[model samples]
Target: MAHCKTSLAAFIFSSSTDQWLAAPSKDLSGLALDKHDLEEMSVAQHYIPKRHYAYGCFYWDWVQFGIKKLLLLDTTNMEFSTADLPPGEWSKQGIAIVEAGEGRLGMFGFHSETSSDLSYTVARNKGESPSQWQMEKTMSLDSGYKYCIRDATQRYFLFTRVEASTSLENRLVVGYFSMDIKTLQLQRVYEKQYYSQYQSYTYINFPPSLLSSRRI
Candidate 1:
């Protein structure tokens, strides 16, 4: 990624050379990019840290001059590109990039600050023409408690539920849950017995051997 005030550039770490090498630039003639559009482009500021990997590509959320775009890093060719965010009112609060089945990119987010419904949209024909977003599904969460999206990856997103409190500092996280993007299933991964402030959650992958039981 490029540093502040520098021309946009991407580099890949070479395991063989043990050094960072410039990534090969791909022909972006098909995209709507121009020199002016990229003049102030950067990945450092207003960048969403939650990265989603799908179909040999990594996706991130980037906001340039109040316009939101998805920064795409194609690992297959070690190239970088950008895509426009899906149309409509999308809040940055809980937005997440996820892998839609059949080698497609999908995004999940709430419609509004007070809405209890979470919407999922998938990008169709990405990189061919201006990508089209199709609404796949909408799931409603429990309206009794307030919820916050903490992190997301693959086909799952981690969220926290807290009792509504007027003061941010006084808010207490009541539970942590994981929502399956495909099935829209909500599963409680953890419940807090004592009061605590909101915190980040991470997904951990355990080997099959550790998850399975074997007779000694």
Candidate 2:
């Protein structure tokens, strides 16, 4: 873990860790994926949401939860909630999310390896699932850098990195998908002109636009 001059901290681990931690900063704006020892940091409230179950019912049981309250100085009127998964509540083997259509909260999760298991969920507010969590119409990458999903101007983007075999290869995968915001239908918008295997691609987004595409 290293903290920059801006006090923004970044944690990098082994190769395996790099594969999973390729997600960008914006996706982590109001949320944290809580693990046992280490977790993502929030520049705002130092808020951390963990997966915990009380009694038979689960409370705050989310693999990753969004930050509902962002009180700068005063932590009063604190609102807390959890984003629920789909109706069947399929455990997200791999998950990613971004802001939905500007203000709504939208997320996509990969269930095992089956395209039929791929699902999407949107929330009006924090921690609240829409009436239904729908399965994506398309399939996700089978392997490589885990797919990170984001929305831009009513279109969804999927990012991943393809690694080259030798030392001379550049480390970036040049592929992106554009999708409809409502139905989760996707079409390939950007693709690699030349086949150069990349180590990994990191995804980050601005409120309304994609900020950077980095190969690290």
Candidate 3:
């Protein structure tokens, strides 16, 4: 796998092996607001660049990018397209949401890279289709990267590296731009992780081969 910004939480599941992708986000619009929704209301574009590809499995291959909307690749022709979760009205980036047993939809979790900070805004999921993008709230970082992951109940487990010494290594930094749902305030959450390795060349799996090997 490549250096992925996160796991397959946002990816849509597909059995085609060739062309499949998924992106999970808060289903707000008074329908199903997830965890990220608690922080923002307006929607804006949040680009998931190619620098954070990390360990991924299952639906991971379908993720082309996470921009103003979630993008997936059409493995049959190596083309990219949209995912099943329609981008909210005026949404920027998508946040994968899961409904907890407590009857609340919230963000499962997300991972970011060193190049950019993860931020979110809210928007309406109204109109005719799910592709309608929207924006609601924008804010700055609140909790550090250590708060990215947590249990289903929202309890968190954070692990980060303090930059005490300078070394020839690349580190993963988690930055969050907080947005208040009610007031539309924004804050930032910044933290870092280290990977003391470097890469000079990159290789992506051939879509054709990736398809043929599938049990389909």
Q: How many clashes does each candidate structure show, in the order listed?
A: 0, 6, 57
Candidate 3 segments whose C-alpha is farther than 4 A from its true place: 1-118, 126-129, 142-216
| Per-residue C-alpha lDDT of model 3 across residues 1-216, encoded as one tens digit per residue | 122322212444566666646444322233233445323322322332322111111111112232233333333333323323423222122243222223222221223332123333222342111343233223233333222221111222122222323443544443323332223333443433445352222223447756564221
Q: Write the per-residue lDDT of candidate 2 for residues 104-155, one digit (tens) a residue.
A: 4555555442233345656545423333444434454545443433233324
Winner on TM-score between 1 and 3 is 1
lDDT (tens digit, per residue) of candidate 1 on 1-216: 543343344677888989988875444342345654444343343333456667777765543233456667777777667788788766545677777777677777876666667888888865411278899888888876676677776768887777765356676778888888788888998887445553465845756667663211
Candidate 2 structure, TM-score to reference: 0.36
Highest-scoring model, lDDT: 1
Best by TM-score: 1
**Which pairs of residues have clashing backbones in candidate 1?**
none
Tell me how candidate 1 scores on lDDT: 0.65
2 versus 3: better lDDT goes to: 2
lDDT of 3: 0.29
Q: What is the TM-score of each predicted model, taking all chains together?
A: 0.74, 0.36, 0.26
Deviating ranges (above 4 Å) for candidate 1:
1-3, 8-48, 63-66, 126-130, 193-198, 207-216
